[model samples]
Target: MTAFEATFEHEARPISRPLRIALLGYRSDPFVGGQGIYLKFLSKALVELGHQVDVLSGPPYPDLDPRVGLIRIPSLDLFACDSHVKALRWRHLRSYSDTFEWCSMLTGGFSEPYTFSRRVAKYLRSSAKPYDLVHDNQSLGYGLLTLQRRGIPVVTTIHHPIHRDRQLALDAAPNWKFRLLVRRWHSFLRMQEKVVSQLTNVVTVSEQSRQDISGAFGICQSRIDLIHNGIDTQTFTPNSEVAVDPWQLITTASADQPLKGLRFLLQALAQLRPDFPQLKLLVVGKLQPSGTTARLIDKLELASAVRFVSGISTEALVEHYNRSAIAISPSLYEGFGLPAGEAMACGCAVISSDGGALPEVVGDAGMLVPAGDSGQLANGIATLLRDPELRKELGLRGRARVVERFSWQRAAIQFSNYYYRVIANADG
Candidate 1:
């Protein structure tokens, strides 16, 4: 661990007050995204620390610990169902927020963050007792401002700005039409940028993210606190008995998205296949069977070698990590690379692209390749696959790094201290 990380871990305060926390998110699904995983583990950790957490979420609500209460604010994008576009009930039209959410998405604008925050503010206004603090998960919007105006102490966790996604997507797009759509999809960043600057206290997943966000969103650096995200080390630990296959490599890919760089990884895999016929890519996401990924696999004639697995238990995921000798994180950008950290925590050697906060997360524990470089990725994976001793050594060191530096207990304590500071500052 770096000296700074070690110091932060050592200085964390373990509080016993059992504070009431209102954790807010626009969307969370335990297995799918980092926000959901953060909510799931953080809420569970807060509960472990003797606090009560109630999650207020929108469409595709998080599957949190049973102890955490869920107040689902229904969205027109129910279950992310594409079919919901045509099946809106008349009663749904009565809800102006729901109608706006549906119309915004249909018109190519992502409106969940704005609509959800409005609903959350409305809910809080009607509740009998206000929460001790309101913790927002990146949905910086006007309603959050309302909460602050009403004297509810609020702290937001900005897991990096959405502008990075827009920039990367614009750079990747072939033409102006796609760029326009990309801008439309991320239209809510304007709301976030305004809201973020006004929010009193903000938490970020890493120092790198905090710095990047401050620069990207033009927010003051002092307003953002760095709370390194955790690895569920016990659940994601090494599986020794699962024999590591020499030619099998694994990665988590959001198949439908371009920013995931799954296409680049697939292209690299295509290059490597002729030289290493036994090689296979095990992707841990639902394959968009009809998307560009499937077409690319067919074009590369790797349809038989690539496998996609989804909805597996944490144990099953760890098992998959163990089955592979090495793991790859090929994201074009990441707020904090959880897949890299999780693979590292599981004792699997990792090769991660130096995208966004990934290098910050890996911190010499694993190999670093330039983002979007298919040749470099192929070389890194090939080297690790050929060198078992190097893989094992890196794997051991990576696991040690996460255990010592990134733990939910540590995050919870740090967050609790920040909670106190925010509350004290508000009162003062």
Candidate 2:
């Protein structure tokens, strides 16, 4: 049976009142990654639909909507501090969870998801007022089943398997030490994988991700709900006043990760350098000064042609999208390619690699290149640049696609309906 086809003792009834929702996240710093962006927009969208939403998050909290209550689920937050070792206090050593968090970081492990889930389970166990449903933002910790066992209806969104990242990182690792460290850091996957098999109500953003979750975690497809995330077109809309730079290109990527396919984009840039010397590339991500991406940039001698920006406001991001001649998404894989959609929403001509659900988002609105193919990427960008009329056509069509297919209002309605299904299944 599909997610909605499940029957419950509650007879799988539709909800009549506003839902009491608790959205959980281990970490949600927008500048850090896309999870923050997901948390921020999803909560806002739910509240706009008349749902009562409270975001429960760990340190490096997300920038949330005013109507969404923020419940701080504090952690050691070692990642934020200048030094993970120095961040630990004497009192922190007394608490096993805090000490585990600190020591795990010190040993190159990520303990936040497992640790945060423990805290949430403990807190909700004592909560006098119960929520209708708990929505987990890819945290997949054992505590989800803990909540379910305690009569709490839990719904979890697994964007993609971190195992993909771990394997890719190992392939990109410079040596055995780094590869071992990457494996150690992602040890929390053991818990996540186990949690996926045990949970009955699960949601995923794309069919690609749903299949991936099924394969990677040994779970059945029937339990996974497919709900596409919405684009905030209001903020990501086209600004006619922002003039495009004919020779400029833009992409949002995790610069240090091999999964983002940034290396291939850089290679494409290098291939086009001789003919398009005036071409400039703008990346909306932090380039770690001492990381692999920075080294590649120096090796490619692209410092002059490329620029990196981070911590910018949404307005600025949309401005960059508006000004770019073409926006490219070269991800090796994605649960859902949000940057491509956001760029499309801003009326930016997009050229996305056939990575994961990118084709689902781009459709016929923009160009599609083979993932990790620098030659194809270069050809696509050069083709768009040589034809301004074609570029303009693609940009207009792209925005129209976003308007027709994706919106937060629509997503909220879908999620609210799924929440009821999960609640009903739990009630059964």
Candidate 3:
């Protein structure tokens, strides 16, 4: 067993009653990203475990289980507006959080995490309701420190550090001007760095993330707890009724994001087209008209071979996975690789890059390729395409792995034990 598992086994204890838990997220719309998904599922799981769970969030609030309460914390939500400058009003100037958010957007800095924390801290301090614990979904802002200082038990979940994202963005910048803009937009990392160093009781989604969080934030490895994220196996299960498309491949990615490594996948798709003229890619994400991925698609002359879809429902996503012969997760790095796990749960033959924590999720059930290598991605895709028996075998094994290892019910139980430990330590 791993050192973390050993430690958890020794210290874990059962709580006598359900917990009044508060989950915090700066912005939580599942369509926005993984954080929203994390909040949505985790909250639902906790409620299933008979805990009173409430999600405190900013604009683009999460679509949560009806049993879980949502306390909305308003922000400027400048990104939703066509023009940040025009979005600001005289009333926004009245609140410091609003003013800071507006000004930060004007200067190309992201202040949502910092501002969200401030709003949450104020709300918690003024409200009479008592929470056994405040779980932060990676805001990592100074306001978390404020709650800790106020004698509140705070457990922050650092789902891989934003430091990794910043460095990757810097590496992908086309020019000095773009590099400068990238640095400016990620300025919140400074606050995150400071806050993480001071906070006690921190946790992460995977072992890779536990190590990365330590390296990126200068924390000790033993200080962070690990709880692997789960897939809703019931929702993502394979549909034997849906016929698989042998020539089609599917992937989920934010097409324009450098960290997602969609460019490499596109390159691989281009390489395979000559050999497999019928091969096509279905990307489950929006295609930005002027983004890097769009330009790459044009240059590769693979526009007709690719299709992009966004804002899809869970049932639709599962159906897509069921219909595809293979699912590929080409991310350069992932905290827990939810898409990969979900695909595995759906019984797709997965071709995943050996990126951060992806190997941990894919395990021996699927094919692995070196991250960011288009040549190897193409080879892996070709191998899966040509071998129908292998695809069927891998699909069954992938589904079994997800069912046996990753489930929200199991995750919720582990988290319940972890929560009691934190509350006990705080009480002592």
Candidate 4:
């Protein structure tokens, strides 16, 4: 039986009735990334429970539930344009924020998080409605401080701190120049670290993330709350008809960064290819062609065996998971490891590393190996590939695990409960 069945079996007791919620995020795409999916389903789930939801987001805004109003706060994302570096028009230069965004990207600094926070801060200040609570999705900025000062009940969810990204990049840097560039690119982490430490009533995606944030940012663990992220078990269920071609494997790599450990997965594949020439990988994200992941792909010469597809619908991604013989999560670290959870939910025999929260997500249902260990990853994949019965058993167990523990409805209700508690504490 699924976890949902157990959660449903127990009668849910509500401490408070519905209230107005304002969810703040920089971006919200249901499938483009996890944050968007978080906002989309969360808003919908909140609405389903008779709460009024308004998601205020910036560029690459979310496709949200129609019942939940989406407030767009635009930012200057030059890279998102069809044109390259030449795409910047003179008009774009007129805005200070736009100029900052363009110039920062040119110089290798990541300015989106800062700029988006500025935009959102301005928006919240101008809004007419008074929300019972303001829930921020990892955009830890002075803007949240502004909301709190305004006497709005503020709670921010840090999926994971960006400091982890910085540290990972530093570890993977091949030279001093690249290390400097990596540090520059992660300059936003300084702001995030500062903001997170000062923010009261913070929430996180997992217990592992809570510990990581406390260790990385020097924040008090008691100030942070754990709210496990959810997966749509109904949507990601298994399809036996999904044909697995060759020694096929699927994974989701949203970015071509070292942190995702795609390079590690490639190395594992390299070791396996000698014994299994039929091995192929299908990634549910695009390859930048010239980026680090792309370069790694070229170095491995597995370009023909590996495929990347992005911007697909949720159903399409589930189909990709269902069709694969196995799903692998090669991330060096994850706050919640959504790909692991989603793949397990889809009934794909999962081979994940003990990277950050992956073990928490995969649990005892799927195979676990050491993070950054290519040999173990290769062996786990080989084991699943060779054993059909084992794969089926693992996959079935995984789907059941997800159905019991991770669901958007449960997460939303939990958030609702937390919001009331935060408010009660404040009132007290």
Would you estimate the TM-scores of all the predictions? 0.95, 0.96, 0.97, 0.92
Stretches of candidate 2 exceeding 4 Å from the true structure: 1-15
lDDT of 4 at 295: 83
- Selected candidate, larger TM-score, 1 vs 4: 1
Question: Which is the leading candidate under lDDT?
Answer: 3
List all candidate RMSDs to the true structure.
Answer: 2.3, 2.9, 1.6, 3.5
For 1-428, candidate 3 gives per-residue lDDT tens digits of 34546645543444458999999999999988888988999999899889999999998999999999999999988889999999989998889999999999999999999999999999999999899999999999899999999989999898898877888899999999999999999999989999999998888999899889989989888888888888998789989999999998999999988889999999999999999999999999999999899999999999999999999998899999999999999999999999999989999999999989999999999999999999999999999899999999999999999998888877788889888878888999
lDDT of 1 by residue, 1-428 (tens): 33223446457667848789999988888776889899989999998998889999986878888999998977776446767578578898888888888788778898889999999999999998668999999888889999999989998888887878788778877799989999999989988888888887777897778878989889777767788899999889998889988888899988867778898889889889888899999999988778778888899898888999998888899999988888999998888999899999999999999888899888889999999999999998888877889999999999999998889988998888778777888888
Best by TM-score: 3
Sorting all predicted structures by TM-score, with the top scorer first, yields 3, 2, 1, 4
Q: After superposition, how far is residue 343 of candidate 3 from its true place, in Å?
A: 0.4
Clashing pairs in 1: none
lDDT of 2 by residue, 63-119 (tens): 999999999999988877898789989998777789998889988899899889989
How much does candidate 1 score in TM-score? 0.95
303-371 per-residue lDDT for model 4 (tens digits): 888988888888898888888889999888999999899999988899998988999999999999999
C-alpha root-mean-square deviation, candidate 3: 1.6
lDDT of each: 0.86, 0.89, 0.92, 0.83
> Residue 164 in candidate 4 has what lDDT?
81
